[model samples]
Target: IIIGEKRLRQQSKDPRTPPSHQPEADITPSPSPRPRPPDNLEEGEVEEVCEISTPPSEVLVVEGQADEPFSTDHAQRLIGQIMVWNGQIDRMRDQIDSMRKRLDTMQQEIKNMIDVLGRI
Candidate 1:
């Protein structure tokens, strides 16, 4: 992305200025240089290099469109929802534990009553 930004900035230069005169940092090296024709070759044999850089104006438009929602209000709302869900989960776990304890106590009481009746 940074390289693309640099290329876009380079392409925004004035048309009158030659690339050779541009600042060194603004230039990016190509993967491979095009092979030059022999000196004796005719002018028609030489290939024209096509510039493929994106315009800086278009880059600005794209960057503007990619801006995301990162406001504090949005973050706070998400955090609040998470906290509410967490609290509800904790309450549910406590209720389950309380019910288990009550069940265990009832079973013990029933066993005690059965033993007492058998002895009688």
Candidate 2:
């Protein structure tokens, strides 16, 4: 029985036997190479090329103040708004907790009333 099984395995492994049917894989051609900058560009030349590429109006110049982008007044207003919203959220959470406690107490009372009526 082992010899017969070995013969069947050898027959299955034969290269002359046709392969199982399978869909052919799609073969796509490789994309073309991208253009690159020349290797011999100097530091100054590179900076000049970048400056030429960018428009002047898009560039920002901050002369006097380092933190001009975020003024103290704007920061204070944002902090005030955050504090007000935080207080409102705390109040809403407290109200929800109280409502849940009331609901639980009412449910317990109704259960007790039902038990008393059942006893009667």
TM-score of each: 0.39, 0.41
Q: Which tens-of-lDDT digit does each residue in 1-120 have in candidate 2?
A: 011111111112445664333323333332434335567876556422211122332323333534334567987999999999999999999999999999999999999999999999
Error of 2 at 39 (Å): 49
Tell me the deviation in Å of residue 80 in model 1: 0.3
Clashes of each: 0, 0
- For 23-106, candidate 1 gives per-residue lDDT tens digits of 323446555665556688786674554545555343222333323424688779989999999999999999999999999999
Clashing residue pairs in candidate 2 (N, C-alpha, C atoms within 3 angstroms):
none
Residue 25's lDDT within candidate 1 is 37
Candidate with top TM-score is 2
Model 1 CA lDDT for position 86:
100
Q: RMSD of each candidate?
A: 21.3, 30.3
Instruction: Give the Cα-based TM-score of candidate 2 against the true structure.
Output: 0.41
Local accuracy by lDDT, each model: 0.61, 0.55
